[model samples]
Target: MKKILLAVAALALTAGMGMAETVRIGTEGAYPPYNFVNDKGQLDGFEIELGNELCKRAALECTWVKNDWDSIIPNLVSSNYDAIMAGMNISDERKKAIAFSEEYTPPPLSAYAALTPDADIKGAVAAQTSTIQAGYVAETGASLVEFPTGEETIAAVRNGEAEAVFADRDFLAPYVQESNGQLVWVKGQEKVVVGEGIAIGLRKSDTELKAKFDKAIESMKADGSLNKLITKWYGPEALVF
Candidate 1:
């Protein structure tokens, strides 16, 4: 009886261990609408909600970790977290560093915002470092001023550090509206398409984890819940899968 009881307890312990595996999700809690530290001082945003739902669907125990945008990838690669759900766009340059799950968002419009409508975007443009927008600005021959955060990039324009700030139109739209005419889109500048889309970042070796999220995302797309969440956070005009 003692031997049989011991074997049964071992089996139960093994099963519990399997069920308790936790996946750590890393994000930059600074990008609003996408992810942000809300008024409650807790991580809250579109990604926060979507990520939690994805974990539930995948049946994976998950937790959130906040990291700076520039270091988010490095930390993930170093095993500080299991995945990245920050508003990171899927790009070839980034793929060299980490693998990505299926895109959750379509290629978003990139635009320039400046204090004046006539501001010359070609003169100087600010973009967050390590972002595709920064790379775009660099290729355009405009002086590229890189900041570590999206907020600083916008502040660069407000404080005259740069002629304009180039970033995702969705991220910039709220600021422009709240600026009360102090900031406006640079006229005559066409919005450019950037990246493939936003997706979860994972280490290449974590194919199993990536597959789980991809499956969850596909289900959301099929059921239209993903579109509802996108529209809820990004507004009705947001692109949906």
Candidate 2:
């Protein structure tokens, strides 16, 4: 009877281990080179790839959840998801809402792009709602037009609704290059430095999950795999850890 009881206990422990919960990572599937829906209608991009790698290294069973950029943090706090791997910058204001893992990418340059080189960025600037760039525009007393997505901000500039659109330089580079002179960087306007480097966001209470990711990130950085992935997505000129 004693031997049978021990066998039952061992089977219960094995079943419990097999039932480990899946960690759901939330992201905005609109931002390119960071997180985006590809032609196959599946999530693909730098963050998607990196997030998967991090999960693999940490031995976490993870899944991706598409969430709008504006409510990404709020949803995370509401327990809609386990973490956020959307290219979110680390800032004090955001830290008040959620904790961040160590930075995975360096602080990126923010710039203004408009139809003309001399566009008056100081007059009317469009930015994605709830982003650091929008906050900067508001503080600078510019006519800060907010959009729900990065694509809309550029559309505002193209349609003369805004004098310029401010966003991450990497996100803007492809548009400027493909515009065929239709869009250009605002002349005499230096790229702005906003927020700290990009990092994964988690609920303040998810210390164990945060620690797992932090360790994985540190491992990638130590072995230089992190830099290689950054270059693969952002190009050789892209900033690294």
Candidate 3:
């Protein structure tokens, strides 16, 4: 009887461990104003703050794990992380690999041109420089100067290696402010920019968790918590749905 009881206790312990509500979050600490590592090497940004709030509402403990942008999704699939909150846009291609929670944030795609004397991106952001390389092939015949990361792209524009970059408006706004208007934004025309909306990436099978997150997001939205965070981050004009 003693041995059987011990065995039962062990099984219960294992089940409890498996049921713990600990969520591991994956993020690229390189995307500024969204997710970035500070001067002290600590992760702090809009996404980070939002993640903490969502987890709180859902009664889940979160552990942040940093990885490269390229590996963020793959790592989530391999179970290296439970969710991704790296300011990722919900795209059809990514949806094929994993499931996404309802969009918690929305930002626009914007273009940035350098302000340094003699700096020009007319050649860099053209079709020839883009991966598609077909949009402006006949009209402009320009080439884009591609960088490995958003930071690098911005740096290139700042250092005169490139003339401009097209990136998330959230990140671009801060850059313009930091550069003291050295970088200019070409406002995106409605319905023409790439997709926009920030969501949490989860495993394809985690429907339960997704539902929970969606509920929390909806509750936050109804309570105006989400708007409050938006106001805190980008002020009144950024009240996204």
Candidate 4:
């Protein structure tokens, strides 16, 4: 009986070791509240913790690596990473290049207008899509200024270079508040402008990894673990889906 028990333990240990697979996760450390670098130069945020949790649940060794948002998909396609955990939206454009797991966050893509206390910014945003440039051009009748990322778009509004910007509502909320409410959403524009939520980006060919991530995300959602994490950083309303 003792020999049989020892043999079972050794087999279990070997199986566990064989199951250990390192998964390299790529994220844009620039997007705050989702994934970003702290003052201490360490990566931190909602997505970072979520990724680690998924890794744990999936029983995979994990390494989180930061990549520029624009290059994230390319890096994944180039085999630089096994997955992407950045707050990337699941859009038709992106889907052509990469696959997405079940959506993790369902935050809306919405428009934000710069408030001058007295200026009417509505008519400006009523025409364009939920994009800062489109809104800026429509409302201010000025040429749209291109910004590389969400942070830069907010900065443009703060600098008065642009009257407003557009981004995922959750991503823009904290910044708008921190900017002293200089930014406000264009009311009644919700049903008209923005669509649904965001999803995780994955390499196009990584079907197996995609399946594992989808299962992991479903598990997170089912266990109420995702709710706790969102509530910690974004509050209840942020989980639209």
User: Which portions of model 4 miss their true places by more than 4 Å?
Assistant: 1-19, 107-109, 117-143, 187-196
Task: Please report the TM-score between candidate 4 and the true structure.
Answer: 0.79
* Candidate ranking (TM-score, best to worst): 2, 1, 4, 3
> Which portions of model 2 miss their true places by more than 4 Å?
15-21
Model 2: how far residue 59 lies from native, Å = 1.0
- Candidate 3 lDDT, tens digit per residue, 107-197? 4444444554344445665221221122322234446565546777777766766555656666667777777767766433211245547
lDDT, candidates in the order shown: 0.93, 0.93, 0.71, 0.70
Cα lDDT tens digits, model 1, 162-217, are 99999998899999999989989988663679899999999999999999999999
Better of 2 and 3 by lDDT: 2
For model 3, the stretches where C-alpha displacement exceeds 4 angstroms are 1-20, 107-109, 116-122, 126-142, 187-192
Q: Which ten residues in a row have the lowest lDDT in candidate 2?
A: 186-195
lDDT: worst 10-residue window of model 3 = 127-136
Return the clash pairs for model 2, or none.
none
Q: Given candidate 2, what's the lDDT at residue 137?
A: 91
Alpha carbon lDDT of residue 198, candidate 1? 95
